[model samples]
Target: MASKSVTLAEQSPQPPKRLKGKKGAKTEARTTQIGLFTVEEPEPFKKATPAVHISAKNKALTLVQHKIYNALLANAIEQDRDHAGTNVGLSQFSIALTDLVDKVGLNSNNRDYLKGVINSLIGTVVNWDFLEAERGEVWAATGLLSTAEMDRSTLTYEFSAKIRDFLVHPQMYATIDMRIVRAFKRAAALVLWENSVRYEGIGQSAVIAIEKLRQLFLGQEGAKTIYPEYKEFKRNVLTPAVREANEVSDHTIEVLEVRQGRAVVGVRFTVARKQEAPRLESVDSDLLMSVTQLGIPSSEARKTLGRHSESDVRNALDYVRAREAKKGATPITNVPAYFRKALAEKWMAPEKSSGTKKAAAAPGLSITGITEEEIREKYRASQLGDARAYFDELSAADQAELIVRYNAWQPMQKWRLESGKKQSAAAQQSFLSWLAHETWGEPSTEDLFKFVIKGLASTATA
Candidate 1:
């Protein structure tokens, strides 16, 4: 399921196909026979997404939120096709909360947590063509969502006008079935899945640099610095992601590591719908979903599911659940991690010492070369989106301190920083630049160009 990305396109944003109604709900399309389990209006993006910024402690989307978002996008696309050319199903549509929860395998018990993820979309800002400074005049940005709220047992939402158009009339896009999205245990696997499917027709993707792959998974914010050594990155993120992508998604992918005299420099992915030897699903999807609800990713879930017998996994889950349900026991702060530890240690085995088990608790707190000329592009857009993203990752207090400094430094532009100034895009952008530079010296164009190519290579599909 390769999705769309914002880069230098051969064309500009397409005009709205439908008449600009005075007002409507958020986005477009999805499909379902019964409104009960039906996806409302889904618009799937292969997860080759825009540069995004969210105002939150954890700036990135959680695994569940990732699942939830793709669900909405999937429905938006199908709904519009069902009611084509008529103003039948406009934006701000609603989906059955039961349907959403059941389809995406979210926990209904954690109501506030679920709602928290859904509501967070409102504050999410998405930017397209921001890196295409070469096409400066065509740069565009918009909120990923305009409004997101729940009414009774149903969730209702709308996409920003710009996003709605992108979802509905995307010049290039791909569908990532919520079913497959559910199977991904890591966000990187989801990202990789999206990248692979886009070139499914061509049977392979363009050779992408290791740095660009990092950006695809981690985004530009500090992504360049995280995995300096390819082996470490491959061990932690790549190996598991590839395994999960192969096992869960229909696509079978092979990694062709590009070696520069024995130092792995980059890799090309060859993808196709797999011709699998029949093997048992082994663990039921429903059971895996329950694991996901507790914070285990689908890839992890799949691995755990495969290593142990279904009964063993079930007994382990029960062990964790009973511990959580213990009358006077301190709550397990991390249900998922603890559960994994349980499976690894075989906590459910009858011969294990009860005393050792009671005394033992889960241990916690266990904690890049760029290709040349890949970054030799002109006009890097100063990577304002990248800067803004890094800025948002700061603590609220830190963000405020920067704003105060900016206000004082540029008094003429101070009004723009004043509270509730709508005409402040310019000011906010400038402040972020100042803050980023003061915080981390300006990034080199070589590095910025590496960031730009995350999406650039995605465009070279058949």
Candidate 2:
């Protein structure tokens, strides 16, 4: 037999769709049989894989606590030092307090009053500094002033004198309520450590304490003014008795009701009768259709669908299995061959068509300015949802171009996503929107717009 070559028409290219404005005609509405997978609820709290034990809960809360602690500490230090045009070394401030107490005479009434003032002022400074130090060594080392910039004389005299003045000034110290401020600082740092211990592990708790203490002195605190490391330790580290007392307090959950933007969704829980943990319940039919229209992942759709019932989807799977067993008709398990062919043809057809024919198919839409590489990059940055949205927005030619680019770029996007170099689906949209506004002249491509959107889609994805 002569050597024969064969082509698969089912795998071959087909024509792309062009955008068509609706004519003034009406047609009967159609109904779709959404797959049962659409009805299945996804467990939001469920572990990503079968092997995992715990849900990724309390992570966002712990992170917020850590960030808030660091921010408050830095703010406290800035308030104290920024007015002086340079940081008053914590060491110099401590020496000034010690000197003030001694000068005021320990046994005298003046000494007692001065001691109170000195203690309160030092307490404020130490509490704030301790907080910054505990957050991380990076903050402590670089917080107040540069290590290379330190001069002993400038710190001892000029810096110490300002702190002394602030300490003795009764009116100013009273106005700031230095003690209450320091207490807040302590609360912030301890909250983070406590949260880490409670949710993460005891090992993390112990490590946090040690790291915080270490960071406060040699790292963030030491970097400021070479203050006696004792000051940071005194404020941060718990004595054996204090540690024992802290353990008693730790068992009780402290729910700080902060106004987080997205997490709260119109549910309230009281101490007496806690509400069941909220998950997606029964989705309205319209919402389900919209979700299907968007082509949401089956897992996500199932999760949303599951939210409707008292029994969680995981718990209900056995019942579902039983129900299916009783039913004679089986579920739809395969995409129709024709539908699959149509899907394949939608993307593959571009390869067979000339570039001019592809562009000419959609009138008044510009593909002349867009490069293949640019389209590939944007498509790579885009999520499946984003690609869908982009598809919906494009004219026939633009959609054709997208089909061509996505077909080419899917492999590259898959690799980047798998490697953890790229952000999630939601982040990609925000980044692209921001990059479009900042780098490009406009938000979206408009037919008669003056400026072409400079392609920053790669940088957005990055």
The lDDT leader among the candidates is 1
Tens-digit lDDT track of model 1 for 83-194: 5557664776567766566556543424465577666566544345332323453555555567878766777888876567666545444435565676666666766777
The Cα local distance difference test for each model comes to: 0.54, 0.27
Runs in model 2 deviating more than 4 A are 1-71, 74-370, 384-462
lDDT per residue (tens digit) for residues 308-345 in model 2: 34223222332323433555856523222212222322
Instruction: Let me know the TM-score candidate 2 reaches against the reference structure.
Output: 0.19
Query: Candidate 1's C-alpha lDDT?
Result: 0.54
Worst ten-residue run, lDDT, model 2?
46-55
Name model 1 segments beyond 4 Å from true: 1-60, 87-89, 126-141, 222-225, 276-462
Which lDDT value does model 2 have at 169?
Answer: 24
Candidate 2: C-alpha lDDT? 0.27
